[model samples]
Target: MPEQYDAIICGGSFGGLAAAQQIGGRVLIIDRLEIGDGETSASAVPIACLEKMDMTHVIDQVHEEIYLHTRRRTQKLTFFRFCTFNYRQFCEDLFARTGAEFVRARITSARAGRVETTAGTFEAPIVIDSAGWRTAAGKGGEKAARASRKSFGVEARQPYRGEGLHFYVGPSRGSRRFYWAFPAGDHVRAGLATYTGASDLSGDLERFCDDLHLGPPGKVHGGYFTSRLTDAVRDGMFLVGDSAGMCLPVSGEGIRPALVFGQVAGRLAERVRTGEMRLDQALSAYRAFVQSRGKGYRILDRLQSVLNVLPDPLFALFARYIATPRMLRYANRGYWNVASPDLLTADKAADPLPATAVPA
Candidate 1:
């Protein structure tokens, strides 16, 4: 017989770990990597998000301003605070708090209550497909899964010190490319991303660091993330994070949404596990929650499309307009609130779990 668990979570990163937090009983989180081994994101998020995870202690630097650089001008806007953090430490700390069993195995397939992995198959009443865009849950198959991820991003760390989160826009790197340098204490996480799904960005990253005088790039890591929204619940499995295409379009922000949606799915799944709600009930509620944000996602998607086609000078002008104090306030408030802490309280609050790690 296959190993059994109350819940089986695929992909043990932000989404999986967050889902694991809300679930009680024998839970298993499977990933090909050891917890905290793979670092994919730029590793920056709104400070409030870290506070909600109670992992703020892993923060490396706090930023209160954004520095936007264009070929024609540079603008500095202050509206909200963000922080760059130690990714490994954050993951390890959050995983320790989940108290969920973890196994380092690549999930090959997932159905309603069964998941096949390289190591073995596991069954659970509750299964979450937080495995990411490449292996979305359900019977979508590999072709459809690959086609859904339309954007590719790559990032590398370099030895440098900088203030605030810096973004660059212009024709220097490509017609539709943007680069960012987020200061994380003594080193900065610098990266370039294209909306066109270009896979080779190492040379561009090297030149970007050269232009910014940040020295040679350190370790590099990144992968595909979707800007287009997809089904949140598939094959009777709850999907959160990139698997559901929850990454923000123009901003490429995935961490916040992963945590937000993961928390909701986990809480609802817990209700199902406890017999307070049926599986279909939890599925409907989660789907409804994801669909409610469709309008915002569409708006951002449109803006990203516009950015991709705008001329350099025209883009600079547009950036300046948005950086105006009034516009900045409006934009900041709307973006930050997308993954607001208020969502965490949407369900009946569960007491904090003891900080413990189920040995992997």
Candidate 2:
């Protein structure tokens, strides 16, 4: 007989870890990587989120402003506070807090109450697919669910000191491509991304580094992130993070949404475990919660579509428009709030995981 658990969570990264933090009973988390072994994201997020997770110790640098660069002009906006963190450290620390059993194994498939892995099979009433963009554990096969609507991003870290996050756009780098440099302590993560599903970005990334006059690229890491939204609940299993296409459209921001939705899903699952609600009720609630952000996702998706085809001169004008006080406020209150209304609030903190429910 397969080992049984109160819940079986696939993928032990941001989404899985966040969900594990909230759940109670004998929770089992499965992933191919030992905790913190892989670092795929650029590792930047709003500072408030770090505080709420109580993982601020891993923050590498804090950025209070963002600079947008175009061939014709440059614009600086300081309406938000963001930070770059040590991804490995962040994951390891967060995992230590969960108090859940973890298995380093490749997940083969997961259905309503059964999760099959290379190691063995595990049984649970609740199963969450937080694996990733190419995860095979969802309702439809990974190919069907993620057929198109995927964006590729790659970045390399190099020794350079910089302040604030910077974004460059113009004919110099292909209008359809977006380039960014995020400062993390003494190093900067610089790279280029194609809105289209182009996977080869090493040459582009090298050119970007040269244009910025940064040092030789060091370690590089990146992968595809879904550019479109998908169902939150698939085949009776809850999906979060890239598995559910929670990465934002224009900015490719996944951490915030993953953390937010993971928490929500975990809490609802706990309600089911404790009989506060039924499994179907939890599924409906999660689906509704994800759909509530539909308008915001669509708006960003449209903006991404426009940016992909917008001319350099018009893009410059749009950049200028974004720098205006009114637009900056809109970005802070409207654009940012779409994922989580309280994300931008300075004083907002995530609810602490219930001690009485979590295993010791």
Candidate 3:
């Protein structure tokens, strides 16, 4: 007889792994790349997640605020504590805690309770589509061009350091495009992210790096992101992380939200696996959780619109005004209240995990 796990996680990134850990039953995670090699950058995550999971060893530096830059002026946005760490190491560390099986293969097909991969076929009562915006290897597929604000980003490490993370706004190179420089681990990571349209900012990454004076750029890489939040769960398929389109509309910041959705999905997965929650019940809970935040999401959408049309000076003023310590604190706490409620009360000053996981 063929053995089946309770859940099969597609795309072993942060959300997938987080789901697996919380699934609390037999599990298998599949990915296209090896586990330890997929770390990414210009990486910044709320400090609470690191401490919540007891994974702070991955921190490269702790920041008190971020620098928001524009053509006219730079604004200092002092938000809640942010930890810039080796995302790769954090990922590798996360997988270690999951007592689940992991396979390296490309997903050829996927549906509720079943997934086919180059390596073999997997069966389970539930399937999670953490396969990301590009993999589209799972359910509730990514949107079309206009509906989805596609993103391509590339980052290079330089031997420079920043006072704090620097975010360059406006379409320096492309529409819906932006640039960033952050002190990573020990050095710096400079990168550009632009929406897909007439602009091909692939080349602009280097120019932006050069203009920012962040030193010679290293290897360039990129990926796409969906702007709108589609159905979070469908059939017996649940979407987590970028698969759920959790990134901020204009900012494209997903790390922490990925963690949020993953936690919610994982908690639901465990209930489903244990026969405590039915498929529809789980789906409804997840869907309502997502839609509950729709108002907040719309507010961000409107703000992005204003940022796109506002004059340079006004935009700078808005950026500066929002970049203050008070505003930063509000942004951090407020954004999460609706976007990432899982960590609403998570404290980062100390390591606190009522339950446990392993780390790199």
Candidate 4:
């Protein structure tokens, strides 16, 4: 019999590996790295939404306070937000648990039925295009709109200090989007998200470090991220994680969505393999599921342009004001939480951006 697989998942990163581990079928996970050297290894891995998922093994309690810093003000938030990781280690563990064939090869070209990789060609009835970048998948053009979103980050080990996580928001000359700082464990990661375009991220990263009084970044590490807002599934394949453009438009947080959809895709793939579900059924379900979670991202994309159109001073003021208690609560628990289909949909009600808040 020909070498057959129920699913061939490309890109053995978080989502790919997660899906592979969760599914019960003959699986082949293809990745460009030497098993654990891609974005998964380099990620500033932080997983939230644990109340709804089982991550006790992966998550570590964050007893420290959480801080949200605006230009002139800082606020303390609830501790429901947890920080847990071992980015590469967690992924490697997941891979080991999968019991699937692993190929340390790069997928060069892809078609509906077969995929060509640096290692060799593989013929799988279901070809999952979790390849992270654009590729042919029985479809034309990109799976989604290619937004110019990129970010750079640096992580280094140091003594453990119980300082809460800090996120800095400031406009960038390179683009309208600002920078971010995620301080987890011993290392403090600072980076800039250039939504407008890609340029010298190193300087932007340095500036981020400078602003936070974290000078002389040691063992610097940085990377880029893209935002996509469209369907991520095709004929016999589905895209998960960064491949599906699940990155948060405002934050560039991809891990949460990646894992969510990864398990969803894995479950659906099993259904497809059992002939209990058609490919379209699975693809459509994943599309609807992501579109629901992505509602906030869609709204954020709209709000970003509005923020850019405003003057810097005014923009800063708006950011500060939104940090207020009542406003922050509503924004998180109300406006943004609509990403969960179980919650209300932004499309079903009044415009989220208030008329007064929006500049004429």
At residue 107, candidate 4 shows an lDDT of: 75
lDDT of each: 0.83, 0.82, 0.70, 0.58
Q: Is candidate 1 or candidate 4 better by lDDT?
A: 1
Candidate 4 lDDT: 0.58
Clashing pairs in 4: none
> Residues 1-360, candidate 1, lDDT per residue (tens digit)?
999999999999988888888888999999989999978888988888887666789999999998889887898878678999998998898888888999898777897999998898999999998987776343556565533647888898888888999999847335477899999999989998888788888998999999989887878889888898888888889998888899999889988898888888898899989998999999998887778777778888999888988888888888889988889878876676555544543233462111111111
Candidate 3 is scored at a TM of: 0.87
lDDT of 2 at 224: 90
lDDT of 3 by residue, 1-360 (tens): 334888899898877877777776779999998876665546688787778777789899988877888887777776667878887787887887777888898887677888888887888988887877764353343333113554567777778766687888764322555778778656877777665533366567778777877655777655665556666775468888777777666676777767767777777777777788897788777777777766666777667656655667777788877766777777766576655534422221121121221110
Clashes in each model (backbone N, CA, C under 3 Å)? 0, 0, 3, 0
- What TM-score would each prediction reach against the true structure? 0.93, 0.92, 0.87, 0.80
Clashes of 2: 0
Q: What tens-digit string does per-residue lDDT give for candidate 4 at 84-174?
A: 4556566676777778898787677665567777788888767776655443342444433233443333343322344556656565343
Better of 2 and 4 by TM-score: 2
lDDT of 1 at 249: 91
C-alpha positional error of residue 59 in candidate 1 after TM-score superposition, expressed in Å: 0.2
Residue 323, model 4: Cα distance from true site in angstroms = 3.1
lDDT of 4 at 147: 32
Model 2 alpha-carbon miss at residue 208, Å: 1.3
How does candidate 4 fare on TM-score? 0.80
